[model samples]
Every structure is written in C-alpha cells, then in structure tokens.
Target: MSSEQQSIKPTEKQQILQMFNLLPDVLFWIKDIHSQIEYANTVYLEQVGVKNLEQALGKTDYDFFPPHIAKQFITDDKKVMDGELITDRVELNSDQKGNIAWFLTSKRPIFDEQGNITGSYGITRHLEKNSQVLSDVQAINAPVNFIKENFKSDIKIQQLADVAHLSVSALERRFKKYLMKTPKQFINQTRLEHARRLLVETQLPISEVAYQSGFIEHSYFSKQFRLLFDEQPSEVRNQNQSMNMKV
Candidate 1:
C-alpha cells in the first residue's frame, strides 16, 4: 500500500472499537490500570454528556459521576484489573445531569502481548433494551415507581411491599435477589439521590434540602449523605457552583 493509504487505514483494534459505536443502547469503554478512561464509544460519551471521546479520555468515573456511583465503578474496575471477569452485573449509574438509571454491565481484564494485565474494558447495556432481564425484576416495578414518586415523604417498607403486592419479607427477598439491596436501603438511596440533585441544582440551605428529601433529622441526613457520597451536602453544592462559574 502507498504511504498515504497505509496512514489512512484503521488498525485492527480501532476497527473493533469502532463497532461498539454502532450499538446505540450499549455503552463501551476501556480504562487503564488506574481506572483512567483510555477509550470510550460514542454512546458512552453521549451517556456521560460529553460531545466526543476526547472530553472523556484520561478521566475516571469520579469526574463524570456522583461519588457513590463512582465508588462502585472503581470497585468493579479493581476486580477486573485483578483478572476477575464480571458478567451481567446490575448497576445504577447517573448521567451528568444526575439522572439515575439501571444498567447491566460486564467487564473483563485486558492483557498485553507479554501476558501482563494492563487494563480493563467494560460494556453496559441499558436495561430497557434487555427485556428478559427487566422482566425478571418486573415484580419490583410498582415499588420502584412508588419510591421515585414519593421519596419526599416518609417511606416505609410496608408501603413498598403493599405497592408491590408482596409480603414484606417476600419484597425484601426479591429486592435482595434482583436489586442487591434491602427495601429500606433502596428508599434511603432514592432519597439521597434526590438530595444530591437538589444540592447541585438549587440554592436551598443544606438542612432544607435534607428535610425536603425526607430526612427529618439534619444530622442524620448529613451523616448518610457523607457516608454514601463521601462529601457533605454543602461541599457538593459549593463544588457545583465553582464548576458553573468556570463555565
């Protein structure tokens, strides 16, 4: 091949990675040992609210996601780097706008020619496209919807169980089986997510944000928020404000 023609040719790895861009509902990404993103498909970039892959390269999940979500991602990445193959793991992810959604993820370690593990790659499919997987957890739909709609109020496990039309124990078992969390944990998570969004988007006082998010005790709200996100509510708000100023 002529020099110019050879220069224009895509490498084998490039060709394979390009295929992922065509899968609209599937997000694909590769990350280095440190969990820095090395490559991401178009869909992955879009999901993270970046216009192009260049904006995402060299960034870790912490850059584009809430701390709680990023922590889970880092944990999974560590397992993959340690040569554990993660398959069909259900996970919650938030976009740049902090809209949370469920996705099915799989990850595997990438090895170099010398057989040393160098990095990892993962694929995440939006659960809506995977009908069978969605149906498997279909029993929780009512409860899930209830939590989303009523997170601002005092939510109870019995309320969720009634919404799902299952006994409290059965609901807990199903939650553990499908969502990997207890009913109460799910309620708290839903409330915390709401509070985080409010903190980033509104100028409300931290205590008010907690109360509006269903936590009656300010100290308890701060404790759970810090425990889950590794940051105080005021810190989250200030960080977002700084970012907005930069823009």
Candidate 2:
C-alpha cells in the first residue's frame, strides 16, 4: 500500500466520507477502479434520480446521463485514475427533465494501501439556472471569465455588459436574477476570494495583497475582507502560520 494510504486510519477515512454526505449542496461520489459507482452522496442520488444508494452502486454515468455526456465523464474518470487532479471544470449537464444545467466539477484519484491509484472521488457544484439556454450560458460565462481575468485591474460594469453583449441595465438584471448578485458585488466577491487565498498562502504584506487583489487601499481591503470572510486578514494569516508550524 502507498505510504500515504497507510497513514490514513480507517476511522479517519469514514469520518471524511461521512462529511461528504452532510454537504447538502455538493454532489459527491466515489467510483471503483473500473469506473463503477461505489458510493454517492444524498444530493447526487437525488439529482440523478436514483431511488437509493443500492440503485446507484455499480452504475456508471451511462446509466444516468445522455451518451455524449456519459462519454465525457468516462474520459475524465480515466484522467483522474491516471493521477490527474481535475479541478473547477465547468460542465453542462441535463437534469432529470433533460433541461441543461451548469456545474463546476472536481475529481481526485483514490489510492490503495500500496499507493497505487485504485479509484476516484469527485464533487460537482451546481451553478445557477437549470433552465439556462445555450446562449445564456455563453453570455454569463463571457462576463464571469472577464471578471476573473481582469479582477486585478479596475473593472467597469459597462465593460462586463459589453463583454456579454448586453445593455448595462440588462446585464445587471440578468446577473441578479440568475446569479443573485449585482455585477459589482460579483467582482468584489471574486477579488476577496483571491485576496483570502493570497493571505493564507503567502507572506505578502496585507497592503500589497490588497492592491494586487484590486482594492484601492489596504483599509478598504481589510473592511471588505472582514465583511466577506468574517475574519481580519491578519488573523487568517496568523492562523495559517500557526497551523503550518504545527505541521
């Protein structure tokens, strides 16, 4: 067995697996080396129309999704088994009624006691609007992608509207209706998420991190960060350092 696998106590494994079941919004599953389902969380079972866990076990994507979608999943499963960690891939899927929905998915390889990859575990986070049209998907992604790419710079709502090919007012309405946030709020959230990661992962001065994350000043950055994460940036960094030292 792989050294890392050997390090995991059976109870620890069970504890982590149980936590997956408790997450109501995320769809989680495990597949065997043969790419057959072995475990599926409650959300996964509900979304895929499986009556029970027993009905889901031993099934593959082909049993729940269209053939084309199944093929894509199978390909990704193989990649995971080959030791790739796939993260945050946006996928289009059909619901039980065959309406298109978008999801952000991730997959990680599961290793045997000897460290050999023996299976996979995955999660999918459903994005907004299960009934979104193909064009709507394109429109939403265009602005979202622009925000991600330009978050370190000053971003204007009108620029986002132009990227999505919608009028300024139309863009605001669509973002609020589908994503439940205004364009500016989404941009701020995105910047804060980046800043949080930087704070935890790097020793950069808070001011520098704030500026890089697109806030005009560290004071504004600290205020917004506290509002979003419920912790001051310094507190998070200190906690991360303490944990690292303990490790």
Candidate 3:
C-alpha cells in the first residue's frame, strides 16, 4: 500500500469498508475534472445495475448517466471549479430504476500546492433517516451563515427573515429560541467580530474599515468600537504596532 493507504487507522479502515458493504446508497469517488472513477463501493454496483466493480471501473460519469443528467452534473461540477464548496440536498428520479429518491450530494474542491483547484471529492447519502432533523438544522444554520458572511451593505432584518422563509416575527422567535439571541444581536455581533479581525490583521484605513465591516456611518462604528473595546480605533492600532515592534 501507498503511504496514504497505510496511514488509515485500523478501526477507520474497518468502518469505511463496512460502509461499502451497504447496498442502499452508492458511494462514488472521482478525481480530476474528467470525472473518471477512482473508487466505488459495492453499493455502486447494485445501484448502477452492474454486476461487479470490474464492470464499473475506469469509467466516466458520461458512461453511467444519460446526456441530460450528465450535462446537469457537469455544470454543477464546474461550480466547484469556481471555488464553491457546496452540499446540495435534492430529490430526483433515478434513470437506472426510475425510482424517485431524495439525497444530498456534498462536495468540496481539493487544491494543489499553489492553491489551484486540482480535483474534487464528494459523498452522496440517502435522506431516509431523520429528515426533520436535517430540515431543522438547515433552517437554523443557513440564514445565520449567510448573514454572517454577507452582513455588509444595507442588510435589513426583513431580508434575513425572508432568507429563512419565515415571517419577520417568526424569524426573531426562532433566533431567540435556537440561538438565544435576537436576529439584530446576531448581526451586530457578527459584524463586530469581523471588524475586530480586519482591524487587527489588515492595513486598511479606519473609514474604509467601517464601510467594509458593515457599518454605514463612521461615527456609529467608532461608538460601537469604543463600547466593545473601551478604546478608540487609533489606540487599538497603536497598541498592535507596539506589540509587533517588541516582537
């Protein structure tokens, strides 16, 4: 075995091979943009209507899926190429068996030494167990993650609520119930933390920092900064500079 293969822990290797023995959901692995098969579990053979792994080896997705399915997957594959690591929960009818199914396809790009997108890895799992839990988790985390990442530039409470597909009041209640904080609190906290990171890490001007950190007004930014830190932005910067000089 190669060093990578040799590094697999004994328990992990057993567990991984155990997953392969399952026949309900197929696991596929592809390396490179060509979608060539790297490895497949025993479940893949049953689902793909193939008799053995030998029959499934060395094939591209084009060999498995029809032109339409192949085209759509190819498009989504290029999305990872564009630096999106995504896990899509979708429902579909299998072309092989014409059975309607619901599953999630999760994939992220693997990068080369210089950070070029080299290949991708993904797992597909059936949504048979605990659909409600999955739904609740998505409903709770999706909006928070989005607003946390894109809190800048005129984000209203209503917009974040709308993203959750909940009423303004209902969204507030959900945040309070699940997160123990109001939506506005979450927004402010996210912005404040992000601003602190940028202030300490980057050489950007304070005015630009305010704008980029999701504060529309410099005065409001300063007031909040002092409220949070008990010091002015200049003081924060000068302290950081002195610390760096000492090091």
Candidate 4:
C-alpha cells in the first residue's frame, strides 16, 4: 500500500475533486468502478489537443485515441482495476494529432459512495527533447554483444575478418590499434572478466563460473584471475563487497 491508498476518504472525495480543478497538470478524475471519464481539468483538454471540455469528457481511450495506444491504456487500466496502482512514462503516437507524445502519467482507482471502485484518475505531463540514454546504453553494450554473438561459433581471425569484411592482418591490426589487444587476447580478457563478475555477483560455484566464462578448466580460470588481477576470484569478491560497504 502507498500513501495515496491510505489517505482517501469519502467526505474528502468532493473536496479532492475541487482541488484538481485548478491544478496545472493534465488531470483526469474518473469513476473507478466503471472506468469512465467523469471530469477532467482544463489541462487535460489541452493535452488531448481538444478545444472543448465536453469534447474530451465521456470518452475513454477508445473514443479519443488510436487503436494501439488505446489498447495499451486499457491494459494499464486493468491493472489499477485489479487494485495495484502503477506509474509509468510511455511514448506513443496520437492519430488525432498525427504526432508523437511522451506522457509521464500516474493513475489510481477511485471509489464511490458504496466503496465500489467507480473508475480511475490520472495526470499526464509532456516529455521534452531528446533522451539519449537508450543510444548511450546501446553504444556501451555493442562490443559485449558482438563478442557474445561471435564467441561460441566459428570466430577465428579469418572468420571475424570476414564478419568485419577485412583481411586477417587488417582485422588483427585494428583489434590491437583500437582495443589495445589482439583478438585472442581480447577474448581471453573478456571471458576472464565475465568469470570475475559471475563469481562476485552469484554463488553458482567456481567450476560453473569457469565453464560459463568460456574456460574449460577451473584451474585455468583461477590461474588467469591471479595472473591478471594479482588476486583470486574469491579475494576480488570480498574486496568488491568491502568497497561497496564503504561507498
């Protein structure tokens, strides 16, 4: 349960209705049980790109939005209908305006005089500008993905060269120039690092981590961990935990 769940009272419902009337957000006051649009503040009308309150009223998502977006809205509405409230930001296209809108929305169910859920209410805020978090994340992850896709298969220097459309020597040259490592060395290093993370983040047992990290032997994994980091996997895990605690 949340603060909102615990706070709503019957007598305060009308007063709550009045409070939202002047609120700046695109606010919707709804009948919870039937999931109907009962009242919307002025901002809601503006958000829907409509000029009249009457035009926006009595219209659920189906009446006001495209089929795809309306279906998603109804899906989320069902969750609130089931008594768990959710808040999310969704980027969607509006056929009415023929443009993309990003809405930061929060919705919850409302109860009526008989304590029956009459509908749900929500507020929407427009998202602004470009968000590069997705692009940054993809760039950061591209190398790992390349390795994952190529690792288990026929990924020799020649095979990788073909994949890169470069000659073997050129591919090797770029690998060393850009990665500061030869292809084999990079693979070994990646596998070893994966071993370390799995050991630290999970209790899957050392032998399993060894195989999963692309090493055939536990002894080899242990040796590489010590040779590379000057510490065993277990020691690194303990050090990581200690550092996390201090932070």
Candidate 1 backbone collisions, by pair: none
lDDT of each: 0.85, 0.80, 0.67, 0.62
For model 2, name the residue pairs that clash.
1-113, 1-114, 2-113, 2-114, 2-115
Q: Give per-model TM-scores.
A: 0.72, 0.52, 0.44, 0.42
lDDT of 4 by residue, 1-247 (tens): 8888668675586677667667664456564354556777766666567787677666776566543345447656777877978665432233235754334567888776997776777766554333442332232133434665555333466656666667878767766654446777767776775676676567677788878888787787799878765578777567656755896
The number of clashing residue pairs in each candidate reads 0, 5, 0, 8
Worst 10 residues of 3 by lDDT: 87-96
Worst 10 residues of 4 by lDDT: 133-142
Error of 3 at 31 (Å): 44
TM-score of 1: 0.72
Write out the backbone clash pairs for model 4. Answer: 31-118, 31-119, 32-117, 32-118, 32-119, 33-117, 33-118, 33-119
Could you tell me the lDDT of residue 159 within candidate 4? 59
Which one wins by TM-score: 1 or 2?
Answer: 1
Estimate the lDDT of model 1. Answer: 0.85
Candidate 2 per-residue lDDT, tens place, 55-83, comes to: 99999986887543564577688888987
- Which parts of model 3 have CA positions greater than 4 angstroms off? 1-138
**Predictions: Cα RMSD each:** 5.1, 15.3, 15.4, 17.9
Per-residue error at 144 for model 1, in Å?
0.6
The lDDT of model 2 is 0.80
Number of the top candidate by lDDT? 1
